[model samples]
Target: MGLVGRVREGTRPPESLLLTAPGERAYVDRWDCDVAAGIGLAHLIEAFFTSKAFRAERLALAAIGRGGTDGEALLLAMGAAQNFAAWTQVERRENEILLEDFAGRTRCWLAVTPSADFTTLSFGTAIMARHGMHAAARSENLAFRALVPFHRPYARALLMSAAHKAVRLRQRAVSGG
Candidate 1:
């Protein structure tokens, strides 16, 4: 994967709650990075939730009455939180966590797998769209189609920004700041 990850033709794991149904679709993108200070899932998650791209999205969600995060972000940064203002922890392990929004329309899976010397971080998202009674609109709805251009770029930006922030954070920590 590149700095922000790779667009791969893959499906979520069988244990994932964001499974694809008969008329639903799933998208998986992965980002892999190796940091000198060794970034873990918690650190990466904190960097993500506090990144510029994510803050903008969080603000927009808050404007729509669907988000909040001052305290939750703090908790997440300290690796002590599971439920944020916009999403709840659907599943978790020592190095991975799956989160789903309250509406259950989107699911995010983040994993940090450690190799011998480098740690790889992967991020994925699954979105489910359902259309009204229609014969051919089973794959995607109008909104989903319209959102494709914007969503793809936003996803990349979000991952990129977060990964960069994690690197910065590691550097600062290493510098004794």
Candidate 2:
């Protein structure tokens, strides 16, 4: 039951997916967990969206809009307003789901690969500064640059928390609790 989170370097979105610019700065944070049983990619995606962690993240974003403190609030506000349903599905495969925002500046992928004993579920997100006059993107980049020192660990922790929530939900479902 070990769940790990890491900052993936030089990870880019699929070439077929035209979202980020060639020279734009992008960051990828991934969380991996081993599930007791194989879970379909669609099920995993549904679990992720329905997880308490996801709900909390949305609420936090709303709170930021209503004046929450700290760097997270500032970063979220500078990025994009919260709209989970607004994220469009770009691709869906047997073990993966790739989603992008309507404007195509942000992307996320959730996948589940079954192994001999357990299934590995991974969630990754990539955010890039949009082209043209994007004040919000610029501000987000500035804040991200300024917060580089704390970004890796902070992102890891956030992903890990979400992964834990998913695991708990799966457990409860299996136990019929």
Candidate 3:
């Protein structure tokens, strides 16, 4: 089976940067992938942090912020960690988590929805990076809007890589490897 994530038509992010105070520009996007039914949040988190694409990001962030060398060890310890590199775990649930950057300009949400046959993994991002305090704002501003094209594909790649990992994990679990 192939590993790819897709966004359903007309389904907006359940929670997003769009909910903001006056003068703040908002933007949000989401991607979803199906994996083995038994997979859970910890598994997904592990796959995400260990994914090649994210590994690069981790190393880069580690250089400028918290050390990405922490790797899966850090992301897997979500229960105890309040900060990861520059992200702070703001909300934790049995199936979902929300993290925000220190500046509060960016937010990430990850979740898993398991059915009888497979689990749907979701990755969402919210950004408010472009705006003037006194400028007119409707939805997303130009700066963040401009980055959407690149950001969409990068985010999808990260999730897709993680999904591939999740599939491998499932195979291992099934085989007891």
lDDT, candidate 2, 10-76, per-residue tens: 2434642333324353655555666665555644665666555456555665565532233432232
Best by TM-score: 3
Q: Candidate 1 — which residues are off by over 4 angstroms?
A: 1-26, 77-79, 129-140
Q: How many angstroms is residue 61 displaced in model 1 relative to the true structure, after the best TM-score fit?
A: 0.9
Stretches of model 3 off by over 4 angstroms after superposition: 1-10, 13-25, 70-78, 129-131, 134-141, 173-177
Ranking by TM-score: 3, 1, 2
What TM-score number comes out for model 2?
0.59
What ranking emerges by lDDT with the best candidate at the front? 3, 1, 2
TM-score per model over all chains: 0.75, 0.59, 0.77
Q: List ranges where model 2 is wrong by over 4 Å.
A: 1-25, 60-84, 131-137, 146-177
The local distance difference test score of each candidate is 0.67, 0.55, 0.68
Error of 3 at 6 (Å): 6.4
lDDT per residue (tens digit) for residues 12-92 in model 1: 466544342222654444444454447777778878888888988898888888776766765865668878877888777
Worst 10 residues of 2 by lDDT: 73-82
